[model samples]
Target: MRTHLKNDIPKFDIVHSHSLYLFHSLVTGHYCRKHGVPYIVRPHGTLDPFMYKRHRLRKMVMELLFENKNIKEAAALHYTAAEEMTLAEPVTFNAPGFVVPNGLNVSEYDHLPKNGTFRKKYPELNGKKIILFFSRINFKKGLDILIGAFDLVQQQHQDAVLVITGPDNEGFGDKVREWIGERNLTDKVIFTGMLTGEDKLAVLRDADVFALPSYSENFGIAVVEAMACGVPVVISDKINIWREVESNRAGKVSSCDHVQFAKEINALLANEELRSIIGNNAQHMVRDYYQWDKIGMALEREYTNILRTRERRPQSFKVRGDASV
Candidate 1:
C-alpha cells in the first residue's frame, strides 16, 4: 500500500484520508505532503474524547511520533458532524475543519418488509409496543442507562418490550443481561443477537420508537436509519447528531440520565399522534438531508473548493454545530 501510494498518489488532484492513528493515513499524508498534493483527513470519530482515552498511552505515543504531524499538515480536517469537530478540536488543534454528515441510500427504506414481518418472526413480541435499540453491544453504547430507563418505562407501559439487536462486543451483552436481570426485566427485554438485511429493516418498520442513549457517538447512523423508517427516536445529547434531530423536530433528545431518557421513550409510546408527527418529520429529514445523493453533492462541493483554493493555506474557522454544509 505504501509503495502504491508513493507511485500513484501524485496522479490524483487531492486525497481524502478516512481515519487517523494508522500506517495508511501516515503514509498517505506523507506522500501528499511530499508531492505538494492537497489532502483532507476525516477522523471518523476516533478523535472524540471518549474514544481517545481508551488506549491513552499508545495513542499518546502515536501522536508524538507521526499522527500529530499527519493531522497538522493536512489541507483540511473533515468531520461528520459539527459537534464532532468541536469535541475533536483539542486533538486537531485549530486545523482547518469542515462538517459533512454520513448519509444513507433512501431507496433502501422505500419498501421495507410488511408491518407484521418482525412480529411474525418473534411471536412473543406480538401485540407489544417495541422500543428498538439497534447497534453493537459495546461499553460506549450506554446500555446500562437504556436498561435502567426501560425498567422505568415498563412501570407505565407494561406491554412495551425492549428489543436489543446487535452482535455482542467483548462479552458486553452478558453484562447488559445481568443489569436487566437485576431489575427483574429479563422477561421484558429481548435480545435478537444481530439482525441484518430485510430482518433489520422489518424490525425498524414495526418499532414504536427507537432509542440510543450512547455515552459518546461521533455520528449515530443507526439513529438516522430508524428515522428513515419513520420511527420516532429518543437519543441522548452525547450523540453528535442530536442537534440535527432536535432542530428538525424529527425526534426527542435527552440527557444520558435514565430518568430523562425514560420520559422521552414513554412519551412517544403513550401518544400515537405525537409519534406519527415526529416519525414523519424524521422521514422527511432523512430524505432531504441524509440521503446519499445529497451528501455526495456536499462532498463534491467541498472537494472542488479545496482544489480551487489549493494555493492558499487553509484558514482556521469555527463551527457552530450546524448540519448544513
Candidate 2:
C-alpha cells in the first residue's frame, strides 16, 4: 500500500487521507509534504473526546510523535459532521476544516423487501411492534442506555420488542446481555447477531422505529440507512448527525439519559400517524442530503477549493543562487 501511494500520490493534484493514527496516513502526509502537495485528513471520529478517553496513553503517544504533526501540516481537515468538527476543535488546533457527511447509494433502498420477511424468520417477533437497533454492538454504541430505555418502553407497551442486529466485534455483547437481564428484559430484547443484504433490509422494512442512542458517533451510517428506508429514528444528540435529523423533522433526538431516550421511543411507538409522518420526512432527508451523487459533488467542490487556494499561496521555500535554496 505504501509503495502504491509513493508511486501514485504524485499523479494526483491533492491527497485525502481517511483516518488518523495509521502508518498509511503518516506515510501519505510525509509524501504529500515532500512533493509539495496539499493533503486533507479526515479523523473519522478518532479525535472525539470519547475516543481519547478509551485509549489515552497510546493515542497521546501517537499524537505527540507524528499524529499531531500530520494534522498540523495538512492543508485541510475533513469532518463528516459539523458536531464532529466542533468536538475536535481542541485537538485540531483550529486547522482548516469542512463538513461533508457520509452518504448512501439511494438505489439500494429503492424497493424494500416484504414487511413480514424478518418476522417470519423470528416467530417471537411476530406480533410485536419492533424497535430496531442496527449497528455493531460496542461500548460506545450506548447499548446499556438503550437497554435501560427499553425496560421503560416495555412497561408502557408490552407488545413492543427491541431487536438488536449487528456483529459483536468488540466483545461488548455479553455486557449488553447482562444489562438486559438486570432489567428483566431477556424476552423483550432479541439479538440476531448480524444481518446483511436482504436479511438486513427485511428487518429494516419490518421495523416500527429505528433507534440509535449512541454515546458518541461521528456519523451514524446505520441511522441514515434506517432513515433511507423511511423508518423514523430516535437517536441521541451525541450522534453528530442529530442536527440533520432534528432539523429535517426526520426523527426524534434525545439526551443520552435513558429516561429521556425512553420518552422519545415511547412517543414514536404510541402514534402510528406520527411515525408515518417522520418516516416520510426521514426518507426525504436521506434523498436530499445523504445520496452519494450529492455528497460526491460537495466533496469535489472542497477539493477544488483546496487546490485553488494552494495555487494562490506563495512557496515557503525556493531555490536561490548557487546554493540551490
Candidate 3:
C-alpha cells in the first residue's frame, strides 16, 4: 500500500488489491482513479453481513465517500465465491465482477509424512473413528454446534471420537472444553493445540471425516484440504462453496442445525461404502478444480480479457483526498 504514497510509482497495467474494507483499500482505489489506472478489489468476505454490522455507521459513510465510487469505476471487483458475489451490497455498483475460487497448492502435501502422527502421539485414539474439527476455536466457526452434533454422532457410533484441533482464539478453546466436560465427553474429545506442517497433514490423512460448521465461510480451504487427502467432509451450507461440495458428492452440506449436522455425519460414518465413494469423488473434484496451476491460468485469462477491453484513461482525474486523507 506504501506504493501509493510515492509521487513517482511505476506504471502497471492493473492494480489488484486483496485488502479488507480499510483506509488502505480506499487509498489504493483513489490512486487508481486519480491516475486512470485499472484496479480490482477483493474484499475477502470482509463485506459480508457479519463484518458490515461491526461498524455500520463508519462503513456506510466510507462507502458513500470513497469505496463506492472507486468500485464503480474499477475494471472489476473480484469475489472468491458465488455466494460472496450474491451477498455483496450495491451489487450493481461494480459494473462487472469476477468470481475466482481459491486454489490450493498441493506441493504442501507432496512430501507429507505417514499418517497416525496423532495416533502415535495419543495411543488411545487407536481403533476409534476419528472425527476432526480443525479450525480456530472462535464463535464464528460454530465449534459449539459441531460439539453438539458430535455428541449425537457418538451416540450412534459409540467408538467415534471427536478431535478438536486449533489454537484458542480469545480462550474459546477453554469454553469449548467446558462444554465437552459438561456433556461428559471429556473422555471422548481430544484437543490438540494448533496443528501445522507434517502434523496437520497426518491428522487430515487419518481422520475418518473432516467437519466444519462455520456460520459463514467464503471458502473452506480446510474442506478442500480434506478432499485432497481423500477424506470426506461435512460442512454447513453457510459455506459459499457448499454447492460445489454437494454437486461433486465431495461430502455433505447441512443446515446450521446441530440435529441436521448429526444426521449427515451419521450417514457417512454408518456406511463405509458411501464414505469411500464420496471420499474418492472429493479427491477427483479437488484435482480437477482446486489445483493452483489451473487457477493461475484462469487468472491470466481474466487479466487478458480486461487488458483487451481496455477503457480510455480519464485525463482530468484527480484525487480529492477528502475522505482518504
Candidate 4:
C-alpha cells in the first residue's frame, strides 16, 4: 500500500483506515504521514478486551512498540461503535474519535425473490421455526456453545430447526457436522456453505430468528442483514457493537453461556408475539441506522475535515539551498 501510494499520489483528503491492527493500514498510515498526509485510523473494535485476551503477550509488545507509534501519530481515530471507542480511549494517548456503525446496501434486497427451497431441501424445516446462523465456523464464533444450547432448545420446541451456514474457516465446520451426527441431530441441523445474493436474502427473509453466538465481533454485518429482512437476532454481548442490536430491540443479547443461550432462544421461539415485536423493531432500526447512503455521507464529511486540515498546514517538500557562508 505504501509503495502504491508512493507511485500514484492519489490526490485526496483523509486517508482513513478500517483497522490499525491490520498491517497494511498501519503501513499505509505511516506513508501518508511521510508525505505530509493527514489521516484518521479506525480500530474497528480490534482493540476490544476479547481480542486482547487471545494474544496477550504479542499484542502488548506490539502496542508498546510499533502499534502505539503508528496510531498515536494519526490525526484522529474513527470507531465503529461506542464500545470500541470506550475500550480504545484508555489504551492510547491519541486525538479525538467518533463512532460510525458499519452500514449495508439495503437496496440489494428490495426486489429479492421469495423462495423457501431451503425448507424443501430439509424436510424438518418444512413446517418448523427456522433459526439461522450464517458466518464463518470458528471457536471464536462460539458455534460449539450454540450447538449445546440448541439441544436444550429442542427439548421444548420440537418443531424448531437450526440452520448453520458459512465457509469452513478451519476444520471446525466438519467437527460441528460430526457433533450433530453423534447427537442424532442430523435431521434437525442443516449446513449450507457460503450463501450470497438471492439465496442469502431468501434464507434471511424466511428465518424466524437469526442466532450469532460469536465470542467477539467488531461489527456483525450478518446481524444488520437479518434485521433488514425483519428477522430477530439472538447474539452474545461479546460482539463489540452489540449496543445497536440491543437498542433496536432486534433480539436478546447474553454471555456465551450454554444455559443462557438456550433460555434466550427458547423465550423468543415459544412466544410468537414477542418474536413479532422484536422483528418489527429490528427492521425499523436498520432503516434508521444501517442504510449505506447515510453512512457514506458521514464518512465523506470526515474525509472533508481531513482535507481541510491538510490544506491549512504548509507543504513539507524540501528545496536545495546553497551553503555559501
Candidate 5:
C-alpha cells in the first residue's frame, strides 16, 4: 500500500509521518528521502519503555537499519512532548526535532447532553457514579490495574459502576471478565466492547470520571477526548503528557503503583464537588490548548520552519553564473 502511494504521489516539501514503526511510514519516508524530499518523523510513543520491553528485538533491528537511517536523514523529528523528544534524540542519528501535542475536535463533546441511552441499556448505573475506562483492551493499557483499583473503590462506594469500553485484544478481554467474575463485581462492572458514533458519545456524556492507567503513552488521545467531554481524568505519570494533566489540574496524577491508584480514584469517587471542579478545568484546557485549530497552528509553525530552512539551502545549491561569467 505504501510503496504504491509513494510511486503514485508527486514529490513534495515535507512528508510528515506520525509513527515510525508503521510499515507505511517507513516505506513513505524512504521514498521521500530517495527523491530528495525532506520529511519529518513522529515516533508517537513507539520508543517508550513499555513499547521497548514488548518488542525489543524487532525494534532494535529496525532501529539499526531503515528507521534510524530515515529519521537521521529527515528534515526533523516531530514529538508530542519533551519525554518523546528525549526518547528520539539518542536514537535519531542526530536529526532536528520539535514537540507538538496530539490534538482533538474539542467541540464534538462540548455541552453534550447526558444521553440516557447508555444508562437505560445498563439502568443499574442510573443512580451511581460511573467511572469509565475507554480504549483498546491491551496489557500495556493497564486494564487489570484499573479493575483491581475499582474493586477497592467498590468497597467504599458500592454504588460506583466501572464501565469498560473499546474492542477486545485477543484474549485480554476474557482475562478482564474472569478478574471481574472472581471479585464478584458483575453488578458493579459493565463491559461494552467497542462502541462508536452515538453509542460512544453517550458513554462519554454520562461518565462521571475517566480513568486510564496506561503503562506508557505518547499523547493519550483518549485522555484529551475525555477532557473535551468535560470528564475528569485519573491517569498515571507514565503517560508522557502527564504535564498537561498536572499543569491544568485536569485530574489526579499518580505513580503506576496500584495502591496509590486505588487511593486517588477513591478520593474522587467520594467528592463530587472536587470532581466537577477538576472536570471543568480539564475541558477548558483541552479546548484552549488541544483543539485542532490551536494544534494545527503549532504544526503550521513547524512546517514553516522546515520550509524556510529548505528554501535557504537546497540539498545541493547551484550558482546561477559560472566563475568565468
Candidate 6:
C-alpha cells in the first residue's frame, strides 16, 4: 500500500486520504486526480501550529511542491474537531470541511471486567493506586513531563504507582527509564513496554486514573476510551478535546507544567469520591457524545452530502491542475 498503487485499485465515489506526508496518500491523491475522482484530506492534528513549527523550511518547500496542491484540490477537508477545521481552513481556502469526531463502539465497554484484571497479573500493583500512562512513549506525547510529575506525586501519595506503557518512539522510552533510575524512582514506576488487546483494556479498566499530558492532540481517542471505562483522565490543556472533557466534567486538564500536572494527578488519586464522581460523568459523556451511533451518523451524512453534491453539480469537480474556480 505504501509503494505503487496496484492497477486493481477499487472503484469508489470518493478517494479519502488521511494525510499529506504519507507516500500512499500522495499516490492515492494523484490517482484520484487523474481519474477525476474527488479526494478528502484529514490532517488529524498534523496541521496544528505545534507540528507546523517543527521543520519550517523543509515543510514549507514540500507544501509548495506537493501538500499545498493536494490540499487546495481536495473536495473537502475533514476535521474531527472544529479547532482542527479552524487550524486547517487557511490552507484549503474554498475547499469545504465537515466535523465528525472519532468514536468508540460503546458496546465494547459493556462487559469489561470491573475488577483488577491487571493487578491479578502484576501482583505488585495489587495494593497500589494505579496511574496509567498508555500511548506512544514519545516526548511530544509528554512522557518526560509525566515522569517528573509522577516523582512529585509520590512525595504526596506514597501509595500511588505509575505505570508507563507503550511502544518506544524516537528512543524516548529509554530516556524515560534512565530518568527514573537517576531519580531512584524504579520502585515507584513500572515500564510495561507495550500492551495491546486484552492487556491494554485490562489496565485501562483497572487503573485508578489515566494520564496523557500531551503537548498537542487532535481528538484524544485514548482519553475517551479511559472515560468510557469510568476511569477519569488528567490531560494537558493543549489537547484539542480538553474543552469537551472539561465541560463534561469528565477529566482534569492542566498545562504541560509538571507542577500543575502533579497537582491534578494527586487530587484525583487522593479522593475516591472525586474519582467516582468524575468517572461517572466521564462514562455519561462518552455514551452521550462519543458513541459510534452518534458520530457515525454525522460521518455518513457528510459522505451522503459529498456524493449527492457530486452528482448534482458534476461540474463542481475540478481537474488536478485546474487552478481556476
Give the Cα lDDT of each candidate: 0.89, 0.88, 0.80, 0.76, 0.79, 0.81
Task: Supply the global lDDT for candidate 5.
Answer: 0.79
Q: After superposition, how far is residue 119 of candidate 3 from its true place, in Å?
A: 0.9
* Model 5, span 134-181: residue lDDT tens: 899888888778888888888888888999989885778888888899
TM-score of each: 0.93, 0.94, 0.89, 0.88, 0.90, 0.89
Off by over 4 Å in 3: 1-10, 89-94, 110-112, 311-325
Model 6: what TM-score? 0.89
Per residue, candidate 2 scores C-alpha lDDT tens digits across 35-79 of: 887888988898889886777888889888888988899889999
> Model 5 residue 315 lDDT?
33
Tens digits of per-residue lDDT, candidate 6, 203-253, equal: 888899999999888788888889998998999987888888898899999
Ten consecutive residues with minimal summed lDDT in candidate 4? 316-325
Q: Alpha carbon lDDT of residue 275, candidate 6?
A: 99
Candidates ranked, most accurate by lDDT first: 1, 2, 6, 3, 5, 4
Q: After superposition, how far is residue 52 of candidate 1 from its true place, in Å?
A: 2.2
TM-score pick, better of 2 and 3:
2
Q: 2 or 5, which is superior by lDDT?
A: 2
Off by over 4 Å in 6: 1-10, 313-325
Report the C-alpha lDDT of model 3 over 1-325, residue by residue, as the tens digit. 4554334222555667775557677777777677766777777777677655777787778878887777778788787788878887554464688888888887676565677776888888999999999888887898888889988988899999999888886987878888898888999999888898888888988898889999888788888888888889999988888998999988999999899999999999998999899999998898889899998777666766776677533332232332122
For model 4, state the Cα shift of residue 49 in Å. 1.3
Candidate 4 achieves a global lDDT of 0.76
